[model samples]
Target: MTATGTGTTSTLHADAVRTLTDWRPADQDQEQLRLDYLAHLAEQPEGVYRSCLPAHLTASAAVIDPAAGRVLLTLHPKVGMWLQMGGHCEPGDADLASAALREAVEESGIPDLTLLRENGAPVPAKLDRHQVRCTGKDRPENTHLDVQYIALAPAGAQALISEESLDLRWFDFDRLPELTDHSVRDLVARARRLTA
Candidate 1:
């Protein structure tokens, strides 16, 4: 499907728009957010793929261990907060789910993390809208419309800190770090239901 937005003509982005437009969110709030994202993408071609604008699409994973008792988190260097591992979508990404999985694997250094999906597309466990500082000076401040998913880590999957992270650790659901944000907990709750 060709996109009717104002941005570069990329079929990859058209696919992303189509995927988001077709997804069924779990609740009314999510439904609204999904529709908003779809509309934004339909109007702004770069809206679905750009990381430098005021509002952009991002994908993240709440990395759940195989036993589902612990979640892997990364201390964001720029934000100075403990958060889930995720980042902006890239051109090579086939879809948003693949983008989320790619970010999870890259940041976790875990080779075999498994993403949850429905009907062959990555199904987000939850959606979050939050403001983020542009980590790079070239990009302006932006709002991240994040597609959050639950990724199952292989047993004994060890997390290593990448250049983007100050630390990486697994926390029990009941005892996340003191610096972890409230949204992390919400992501966990949604993820638990998905994994259960």
Candidate 2:
């Protein structure tokens, strides 16, 4: 596996391109989004970073505790929604999966999380495109082209809330809070299937 958050912007950019190129989409919509992400990276070489405009690539992960039959979610302060842990591709992020794992660790405060892999590789389980004021409330809304992954956390793991989140909690697979949107629900379902 590629080391997380240990490369330069140029290297991270290249890895992003290669990752999207090699990723297999589960459906036509995801395929199109994959193509669109590739196009964005081509046009804007720095699209993997948060500084990119209009749209940028972001990495996220759903933290699943299969033994406990639950998933960890954060109540985002900015979006005011219960969602997975993720953010911009930082300079230290060696690859998309590493970035996702880093975000998962930081957001969930779980030190021993491992990514759910396919064919022994940490690949994305889903892709989502959404608009957000990621920069700040004063800044214009930008599109987040998110690459989502599933991470496995140790059972009975204790979590600590970070500044980015309003609250953090675990929810049963079938009993997610109403604050979560369809996208999050979809991610949870996908994570569940991956673990099961």
Candidate 3:
């Protein structure tokens, strides 16, 4: 993957492009496209074709207060949406989990946090796949592979809004704001079901 000041980009071979274009949206089509794209890259001759695909790594904390039935959320500026705390995965990070932990700490002032996974493990999963239009000038066709995880934070923690966010607060599930992104709402629903 190659990323410039504008955005990241990735190139696919003719066959890969054809496959991606021919794919029909289905429950498994998303995963199939990802696999095909990865395989296409694996078969490419090194240095011949440079990819500008951006690796988007995000970590979301399910700051749940079971008694209060509330979860922490942030209002993002770019999308003007209220969602979990996460951002792009940076280089030399321990892993995606570490990136999530770092973002949660930076966005919210909760110093003490615990990441919860099935069986109390830290294993990562392919939460979902998305095709986002590039906002950068270099490559306008760039898309993101968003990796999501569930984390836990202490109750009544004060949030420290960074420049990336407009506001932050703990919201009840039933009282969630009018979200601009359907994917984010899906994540919230999934998290609620899992936590409940």
Candidate 4:
């Protein structure tokens, strides 16, 4: 498994190129996004690391408890939606999966989460490209090329709301919030299937 947030991009392009080469996106849209991310990486070199520009790479996680009966979600402060835990990539992240796991642990406050794997490789189930709200002077509105992963949360794992989130809660797989968007629902379904 890739170590947690220990590999920084050698020249701003190395990390993104390396991680994308290893990732296997699950659908057509995802495949196209991967190519777009690669193009972005090639063009900007720093695209994989920045979050405040026109387009930047981001990582996120869909966390499921052991039985897959529940999913951990956060009321995102910027989006105001009960969504999966994730955010911009950090320089310390070893790979995309590591970045997702790091965000999961931080946002969900679950200390013992692990990435869901198949055939001994990290399983990246989906990709999301969405517009982000401009919430800070340095964080102007932009699109995030979000790499999504599924993670397993140990039984009885507790959640703590970080300053970035308004609240944190676990929703039964069958009962998500009204405002949870369609893409997130798809992510939940995919996570359930992949982790099952």
Candidate 5:
């Protein structure tokens, strides 16, 4: 849970953090742009320049159980909402898939997870738009070009549930609780279709 010099701050285990930090996608264009923009913002001092910069950036991973018709989800602490396991992409990570896998293993405690990709090839995932709750004087806007992937777990896989989550379980598609986040529901549906 110690903070790495790379700016990732989380209470998850050190191995989890290291695994995610080491992830790298096959393509380098988008990764390069993110690094360049982040560097630009970092070099500017706190002033008018910093005020105009974007405040939120992140990535996520979806873990689906095809045979059981279920998906693993965590009830997040910050929003008290159920969500897929993921977080901000760290510097030096190669791509989103690695990040997603790392997050999945950390949050779910499922070590034998495999990422679902198209034709056994790495295709770039589409951008996903999301919103964050207003924090009093700070109405922070959040958007992420999530590299969505379908990941499969063996039946009866148990989740180790991290401190970041209030609860963790595999919920059947038809038995999913009423989720407050629409994107989460959409992701579940998409994952089901892809795996089926």
Candidate 6:
């Protein structure tokens, strides 16, 4: 599980490689993306870290209020888009699931959000690879190979906006804002099926 070049090791990076290697993709497209992620990890020891040039692995969660048939989204300041809650894996993160959950809770400010589980552990509901300007306004774009999950918000849960977001709001599953892209919608659809 040690990355070849870095000499230094990261448990998060090792966990990511193991998790993706063990995951069973639902379709051919997912299968292809899974392989691509493994390849990235194989070549770059820092692939799970944001500092990895060009591309890196990110963990995210779609916060779903299943009782209300709503999904909580953040108005990302950088992209100016309504998107899921997540970010780069941190050093403290024990695994991809923990990273995704930490991002979800921190971004949403909803303390009790719980990840939907599979086999008694939080598993990714979907995977998305997208271009982003994560470093700064002046920096070139990077690719985020996002491992997406679903989190269930407690009844009457209220979200506070973090500095990372311009705003935070919950929208009906059928009425997500126009600012969102197909990736968000697709993630929501997969979350919906998981919750159902």
Clashes of each: 0, 4, 6, 3, 5, 0
Q: Give the least accurate 10-residue stretch of model 6, judged by summed lDDT.
A: 1-10
| Rank list by lDDT | 6, 2, 1, 4, 5, 3
Off by over 4 Å in 3: 1-51, 54-63, 124-126, 131-141
TM-score of every candidate: 0.88, 0.93, 0.66, 0.87, 0.66, 0.94
| Runs in model 2 lying further than 4 Å from the true structure | 1-9
Give lDDT tens digits, candidate 3, residues 55-124. Answer: 3323345455544667678887755678777766444343456666777777776778666566555533
Task: Report the number of the highest-TM-score candidate.
Answer: 6
Give candidate 5's whole-model lDDT.
0.60
- Residue 55's lDDT within candidate 5 is 38
Report the C-alpha lDDT of model 4 over 90-138, residue by residue, as the tens digit: 7667667888899999988888899988778776778889887644646
| Alpha-carbon runs more than 4 Å astray in model 5 | 1-57, 123-126, 133-139
Task: Write the residue-wise lDDT of candidate 6 on 125-188 in tens digits.
Answer: 8799998889988999889999998999997799999898999999999899999999999999
Q: Mind giving the per-residue lDDT tens digits that candidate 5 earns over 3-89?
A: 232333332223232422333544475456435434433452221111323433345777888898998989987778888887665
* C-alpha lDDT values of all predictions: 0.80, 0.89, 0.54, 0.79, 0.60, 0.90
Per-residue error at 50 for model 3, in Å? 14
Candidate 3 lowest-lDDT run of ten: 3-12
**Whole-model alpha-carbon lDDT for candidate 1:** 0.80
In model 2, the worst 10-residue window by lDDT is 1-10
Error of 5 at 152 (Å): 1.2
Global lDDT of model 4: 0.79
Instruction: Give model 2's TM-score versus the native structure.
Output: 0.93
Candidate 2: give the clashing pairs. 5-92, 5-93, 5-94, 6-92
lDDT of 1 by residue, 59-140 (tens): 8998988474889999998888889989988877767778899999999999898898787756778788888775565655
